[model samples]
Target: MSINKFIKASIQEEDQEPSAPSPQAESFSDFDRAYHSMLCAGCSCLCDDISYYMKEGHVTRTLNLCEVGWKRLCAVSAEDRVPPPSPSLLSDTVNQAARLLQAHPPVLVLGADNADEAAIRTSFELAGTFRGISLPWAYPGIRRFYERAKRFGWATGLLDEVRDRAESVIFWRADPLVTHHRHLSRYSLFARGRLTERGNLDRNLAAVASHETVIEPLCQQFFQLSTDQDSALIEALAHPGGGGGLDHRDLPALARALQGSSYVALFVDPEKVTYEALDAMFRWSAKLNTEGRKRMVILPLWDAGPNIEGFCRVSLEKNATPWGGPFAKASAGTQPEDTSWEDLAGTVGSVILISSGVDASPGNVLPKGLSEKPRVVIDPFKRTPALKDQVVIPTALPGLESDGIFFRADGLPFDVHGIEVWRNHGYPTVRDVLADLMSEGR
Candidate 1:
C-alpha cells in the first residue's frame, strides 16, 4: 500500500491531535459531562465499549474497564513522565535512525505485535526498503500455528460466532478470567446468543490443564495433565481405549463429549502448550471434522498484543507468507533457525522497537548485552531507555492520544479514535513518526 494512500484514506489529519473545546462550550459544566466512548488497546481483547471523561482536553477518568484495560488507559497520566524532546533533538534522532538504517544491513524491525495496523504496515515497508528482518516477539507455539494454518488450513470462526453457535467450549490452559476478564461475560460461556439463548445453560464447558482455574466450577469436565504431559493427554483423547495416566473413566466421557457436540470451540493458550502439543491438538480437531464431519474448531486464546494478528494478515497479503520469523528471501532456501529475542538482539547490529503501550509481564525481557547495543525506542509514556545508546522518541499512545486502526484477536480490523488529548506532551502516533522517517530516509 502507498504511504500517501493509507494516510489519506485511513487517517484524518485533524484526528492526530486532541480537538480544543469550542469557546462557547468551554464551561466547567461541560467538563463534568464530557464523557466519550472509545476503544481500549490494552490486551488483544480490544474492548470497544470504553467510556472516559475528558477534562480540559485530557482524560481524567474512565469506566467499564477491567483492571488490565484500566491500567493501560491510566498510562496517559503516569507520574514518571518523560518530557517531550526539542524539535532539533527530534530531527537529530530521526536522522540518526535513518543513518543507522542506511548503514546497517539486516536491521531487525522488532515488536510488530505491540504496534497498530499503520505502524505494522510501516515496519514491513521499512524492512522491505532496507532489506531488514521483521519478526514479532510471539510465542513459539503461536508462530507454529501460523505456519500450520498456511500449510494445512484451519477451521476457525469469529468470537461472535462462538457465542451464537458453539454448543461446547473447551479451554486448554486458557484462563479467560485472568488474561481476558470480559471474555466470558461478553463472548463465550455466559453470553446469551442466538442459538445459545440460555447462555451457560445451553453450553457445555471443559478445561484441560495441569491444574484447575476459576472456570473449573463451570466446566462439565476437567482434564488434568501435568506439565509436559500434554502429549500424553492428547494421545489419551485420540485413543480412548489406550488410556495412559489419564483416568480411564474420564477419557471415555471426554471422548464422548468431543464426538457428541455438533459445534465445539477449542481455546488454547500458546503460553501454556508447546508447539508440538498445540499442533497435535489442532490436527486431532481437524480429524474430528474429516471423520465425524463435526463442527469443531481451534481458537487461540493468547493475544500476542494489539494488531499482532494484523501484522500476520498484512504479511500474508503482501508476501503470501506468515509473520514471526525472518522476512522473505528473494530465493527460497532452507528455513532459518528460530532465534530467541535475546539471540537476535546480540546478532543484529541495530534494532528499531515501536513499543507504545506494550506490557510484557510473564516472559518478554531484553537482555543487558542486547540493551547495550544501539537502538531506537518510540514510546509515549517516556519509558526509560532500555538500550545504552538509544533514541527514545516519545510518541502518542494509539487508542488514547492518537487515532489509528488495530486488529482484534480474531483477526478483524477496527478503527480506534483518539478520545482525549495531552496538553503537556506533543505526542505523535507511530504512523506519523514512521511516515516522517520514511520521507527523510528517502
Candidate 2:
C-alpha cells in the first residue's frame, strides 16, 4: 500500500468516536491480528498502552496513540526509507567508513538521542575504539539542570506519582500541548488518578510563559512575561517577601496558587529559559522542600529525543559524565558540563551519525563546518541527497522495526517490541552497523 493510504487508514481508525466498540470487535482473519502493550518512541513519554491491528502487514487500526505516535508507526512505510544496498555494496561502504575513521584519527559520533540503549552504548564503544567522542543531541539547559540537581539535590518523583497526588501544577516555560501531546491527558493535567479523581477540577493549574500557549486557558492563573523577565519572576517566586522589584500582573495569583497547594509540580522547559533562570528555579524548589511546609518538585519539559535519557544514562555509566566525552584519560575525572555541537565542531576530523525518525537535513541541524566534513550516517530514512564522499547506511527503525530498550523522558526504561511485518526489510540496526564498523576497523 502507498504511504498516503496507510496514513489515511490509521487516522480513520484513530478518529473513531469514543463510543465505538473495542477494536477486538472486528473479525480476526489469518492475516489480521492485534498487538498490545506496545511502546511509542515518537516522544519521551514512551506511551506504552498503545494497541494496533495489522492486516496483511499493514497497520489497519490503532487505539490510544496520538498523532505523533501514529505518524511514527506509519513511518514504517514512509517513502523516504533508505533502499537496502547489495551485500557487496554494504561491505564496501562499511570498509569505507572504517577507512574514514582511521584516517580522521578522532571521529565525532553524533545522534544517539533517538537510538536505543544498546545502540547508544555501541556508539560510545565505537567512539572509544576510534579515539573519538560520542555526543548526543540535547538541550543545553537540561544538561545544566542535571549538574545543578547533582550538587543541590533534585526533589522529583515519577509522573505517575504526580498524577496521583499533585494538588498544584505550574507549567513554567513548558508547552506540553505542542511538545508532548499526550503528556497532559495521560500523566499530568487531565488524567484521572487514585487521588486526583476529578483530574483538572481537583487541582489548581497555573502557567508561566513568555508568550501565549494553548494550555493557558485551562490554567487558573497565567503569567505572561518577556524572555528577560524569567530570572526576575523566578527570583520573586523564590522569595516572595523580597518582591524582587518585578512588577508582574499575575504574580499575586501565581503565588497564591503555590502557597495554597500542599503538593506542587513545576514543569519547566529549559530550552525556553536561560540557565540562570533554571538554576534559580532549581534552588527555589530545593528551598521549598527544605522548609518542610510544602512538597514542590521541578519537572523539566524538553524533547531532546525519545531516548536522550538513555544516552545520558549510558554516558554517566561509561564516561562518568552525563555529557558524552572524556576521550582522553586526563579528563576522566572532570566534572559534568554541558557540551554543544559548537564545542566539538572544530575539534573532530569526521563524524558518525546514528539517527532515526529525523526528517531534517544535516545542513539544517548540524553545525556549519561539521556538515561539510567526512561522515557516515546510519539511519532508517534517507536524510540527505547522495554525496560521493559520504556513506549512508540503512537501518531498521527501533521500537517499530526492531526491538530494544528505550527510556522515557522521566528516565524510566521500557522494552520496545517490533512487529514481525517489517523483518523482511533485511536492514541492519544501528547496533549491527556499529558492530560491523568496529569489526572492520580491527
Evaluated with TM-score, which candidate comes out highest?
Answer: 2
Stretches of candidate 1 above 4 Å error? 1-31, 34-37, 58-61, 100-104, 210-220, 239-245, 248-253, 324-337, 356-364, 367-369, 420-425
Cα deviation at 382, candidate 1, in Å, is: 3.4
The digit string of per-residue lDDT tens for model 2 on 1-442 reads 5534543453454445234355566666633678897888878888888877777787777778876677666667877766777788889989989998888857888888778899899988888788788876653555677877887799988899889888889888888767777787777877888888988777888888777886776677788887778778888887778756798677887777778778889888776777677778788888999999998988877756778878888989997877675634212333334334555565677888776455656655677778877888887756466865678888888888888999877788988888877766787788889989988877
Q: Give the Å error, residue 252, model 2.
A: 1.7
**What C-alpha lDDT does candidate 2 achieve relative to the native structure?**
0.76
lDDT agreement of model 1 with the native: 0.68
Residue 414, candidate 2: C-alpha displacement in angstroms: 1.0
Backbone clashes in each candidate structure, one number apiece? 0, 0
Lowest summed-lDDT stretch of 10 residues in model 2? 327-336
lDDT by residue (tens digit), candidate 1, 274-296: 76787677777777778866687
Superposed model 2: Cα runs more than 4 Å off: 1-31, 327-340, 356-358
TM-score of 2: 0.88
RMSD of each: 9.5, 5.5
